[model samples]
Target: MTVIAQLSDIHVRPHGVLYQDAVDSNAMFSAAVDSLNSNRPEPDLVVISGDLTDEGTVDEYQKLRELLARLRQPFVVMPGNHDNRGNLRAAFPDHPWLPGEGSLSFARDVGQLRLVALDTSVPGLHHGELDAASLAWLDDELTVHRDQTVVIFMHHPPFMTGIPYLDIYGLRNADALAMVLARHKNVDRILAGHVHRSMQTRLGNVPVLTCPSTTTQIALRVEADAQPASFLEPPAYMLHRWTGRGQPAVSHLCYVGRFEGPLPFA
Candidate 1:
């Protein structure tokens, strides 16, 4: 069995940079880190689906790198819409998702899983696109690895969830992505971050998993007919497991920090 943990939307500090969330990202991220390190049956690999930093600053990335360096397992990090490609590249020089870079993919023949990181961030913007070039590259890569089981990791999701405010910021060139996905049958699951919600759905016959954030939730419910978002809930993270012929895969969703109460369950 191959174990993969998926952590999304880590809004690491150097706060006040994003000006929106105002949440202390480093603290929130640490809660997740502590939980993962102390959990039973540690994961084999970790995948962070972007939003590593709030304002995408070098200092923020520096702090994030230092924190992630504490993990007991190997991990791959990607960039989300709020991430700055240049800062991320320099912070993690060997990182694969750098702009204009060839590709950042890891192949584990032993586990029969090929982990692919797709760069979906649009520079100087808060949306995602699979651009013609990226789509072409993905198509070619899938064709070559037709026999290999694939799990794609990206920052943005291709489908809309009717969350209204969040839905407006979903992927743009989704049709292009959908067309490419249809041609490949080896893809097991398409995972993403950005939305900061634990949203699950199917796209092109494959499951799309969006891991929640470590800072705060965008409030799945509308406060009023007009209000859009709220931070009234605790932060959270996810773990994804893959079970093969010999190994089994399991994914877990964990909430960080303490909440109100147990509510006296029956």
Candidate 2:
């Protein structure tokens, strides 16, 4: 069995600042890293979906790097709308997967699973789009790794989550992405961030899941004109376990705080 831990929207602060008004994003993220590091059975890898910083600043990224360095398992990160591609690449020069100056996209093989990271951030906008080049790269990568179970990682959810305020900034070229995914049968799941809530949906035959932010969660309001809002809900992360071929993958939403439980039912 191969287990992968997914954490998103860490939103690290510059120095001594809280996200929104209540969330100490830095503290929450530190706790989350500790949880992942101490998890039983241990995860093979950890993937941070995106939004590593609140403002995509150098100080924030530096702090993020410092905090993540404590993890025992290897970790990989993609960029979100709040991220600057050039800064991210500079912060991690060893990450050859990141291009010199374009969208950061690449594929890595771990055990029997093929992990594909896609850059959906649209330069200067909060909304995301998969440009022609990104789409082409995804298609080719999926085709080349057609025999292995592929999991996609990106910053944006390709489907709407009914949160009107958030949806307004949703991915713009979801249909185009769906077309590419439709041709690829090896894609087992598409993992994403930016939604700041735990959500599950389907894109074509592939399962698409969005992880809750490690910093804060957006309120789940469905009104068409709902305003942007966030809550101090307990931060969480996701664990995905693949039990070899022909078996369905299992996912668990893990809260980042300690809670008294696991007591045996009488």
TM-scores of all predicted structures: 0.87, 0.97
- Give the residue spans of candidate 1 off by over 4 A: 15-22, 94-110, 221-226, 246-249, 258-266
lDDT of each prediction vs. the true structure?
0.77, 0.90
**Runs in model 2 lying further than 4 Å from the true structure:** none
Please give the RMSD to the true structure for each candidate, in Å.
3.5, 1.2
Residue by residue across 1-266, what tens digits does model 1's lDDT show?
67788898887776444325466667778788888897678888888888888778888888888888788877777888777877777888765444455333333332678777888878888878877778888888788989877888888898886777776678888778889999989888888888888888888787888888887777786333535775736777777777776332456788777668879895
TM-score, structure 2 vs. true:
0.97
- The residue-by-residue lDDT of candidate 2 on 1-266, one tens digit each, is 88899999999987788876567899899999999989998999899998988888899989999998888888888999998888888899877767777888888987779999999998779999999999999999999988888889999999988889998899998999999998889888999999999999999888999999998799999987788888889999999999987565788999999898879995
- Which residue pairs in candidate 2 collide? none
**Whole-model lDDT, candidate 2?**
0.90
Error of 1 at 52 (Å): 0.7
